[model samples]
Target: MHGSPTGGMPNQGAATHGLAALLLLADSRLPAGGHAHSGGAEEACRAGLITGADDLSRFLRGRLATAGRVAAALAWSACSASASWELLDAEADARIASPAQRQASRTQGRLLVRTARRIWPSATLNDLAKALPEGSHHPIALGVAAQAAGCTPDQAAMAAAYTSVTGAATAAVRLLGLDPVTVHRVLAELPYDSVIAEQHDWSALPAHAAPALDLLAEQHLRTEVRLFVS
Candidate 1:
């Protein structure tokens, strides 16, 4: 299955180079619609909960532990079994309580799948497109994309977990006028790698909840003026 998906052996060198593929999928400039969303950092900032780098670090850690963990697990699961993507989509929807968050996930998922189709066309992705025309949740699409890109499940999980912070870290630079360099430094110092290490069991995906974040998302949607979509 690691090969061309036609029962042929994959190139050894290319398989070993999966790290590069993972990076490309995880990069912020992949045109996957991640840039348009803040993963709730924007709302938290406006609510006076996040004022600077210190607060951002705490927020990122909490997010990594809860929402990020669930996303990474779903991404890894999708890569492990692309056929079960529909069930995984249901699980993602069940995990997300807020309607706004669910919409944001589907929106980002649609964009990522569309972009991935041009770069790494595959029957799996095409089937996914047909099955979930509105688009699967973001992590589900990301996992399938990782599979198409020849990445392992663990690599996909790491990419998913990393984006949980990097997206918000970038947003903080814009919203708070925080020093980009220092914000990145804060990102570098976070224990995201540890979180990824603990996410090996796709079947036992964490269902941790952040009610405050859910409330914030609802509040963000109601706000008259906002910069980010979610």
Candidate 2:
């Protein structure tokens, strides 16, 4: 009888625990500072890029394919390589082109670490905190937190991919006054399965840069009266 990966639990028990953890981490109300930033959706909306649900859908899909893909890959890599936090962080830093986006990522990561530490204490989490005194990239923190919560690398990637659009989608609903049901339906129909597929090379991560998103983030940073932090 072999032990399951989740603290030697049975297969079913481990699966259940992993699912619970995944839901917990994926929840938007986890006090991870995700609500404060709109993942650039606010700026896009203000820039007339996302005026309604249809525009929001396009924005989300593009975001999912670019930034979302990169984030999923990074989270997957981080979950698999606990000891390579520094390298992974560097990779994340390199992928993000905008200074505003970088600051937002670290801010979210810092909040997530603070919250996850109380929920799932582990040496890995402590090591991550020490390695990046300021904070890690959000996906890196998410990957590590997923591992601490008994989730697999694939699960971590899925969580990362899902969040990449969800926050923006939510923001669109608030910013444009779009129908929440319509927004949610668009989210449900996103091509997440294809984006978060398994990757072989952790060193060669996907660098799908969203130049528009980068520009939007920079523009958002300069706006004096903005709704989101990013």
Candidate 3:
């Protein structure tokens, strides 16, 4: 039974393989529909709230503390309990007040699942597809995908936090024509490890509110001319 043909535990290299899987999910080029959404950066810019690197830094930091933290918590919960997809999906809906934001999340979630199915097949993901035919929320879908990829809940949470800021950071670079290096330096300096460390359970998901961010999403939807979708 040392090397049984009947699917035994993974080899010692599995941890290294899991780290690679985690990086793949965190990568911006994963075809998860992330490019189209600015996480509200475009709207903030249009309102003159985020004109330069300084404003961008403040905006991204606020987002990371509020929405980003919430996403990481939900993703941690979902990855930790793959059977609770429905519950987590409802929770995501309840957390997001704005209609535009909800639509944006579902759109991204749908795209993530579409790509994840091809990359990392799993019964949980298939079930999620059936549960929300349109799509589960992005964080929930991401959590399930992370579990399938053999990542721990903490790793999933970290990825959630990382993507939350990086998406907006990249969008700022494109919309403002700011020096990409400087913008990235700002991103590189974020206290992500501390933020991730604070996320311990679903109950403490840090629902810090930023009403301006929600309002920005609403206004961004009405803009007659804009670059990013949300």
Among these predicted structures, which one has the highest TM-score?
2
Q: What is the lDDT of residue 44 in candidate 2?
A: 91
| Alpha-carbon shift of residue 140 in model 2 (angstroms) | 0.3
The CA-based lDDT of model 2 is what? 0.88
Model 2 CA lDDT for position 48: 92
Estimate TM-scores for all models: 0.92, 0.96, 0.92
**Candidate 1 residue-wise lDDT, 21-77, digit = tens:** 898998998888899899898999999999999999899888888888888888878
Candidate 2: the clashing residue pairs are: none
**TM-score of predicted model 2?**
0.96
Best by lDDT: 2
Clashes of each: 0, 0, 0
How many residue pairs in model 3 have overlapping backbones? Answer: 0
lDDT of 3: 0.81
- Cα shift from native, residue 214, model 2 (Å): 0.2
Q: What is the per-residue lDDT of model 2 for residues 65-162, given as tens digits with 9 covering 90 to 100?
A: 99999999988887776686888899999999999999999988988988988888877888899999799999999988888888888999999999
Distance (Å) between predicted and true CA of 72, model 3? 0.4
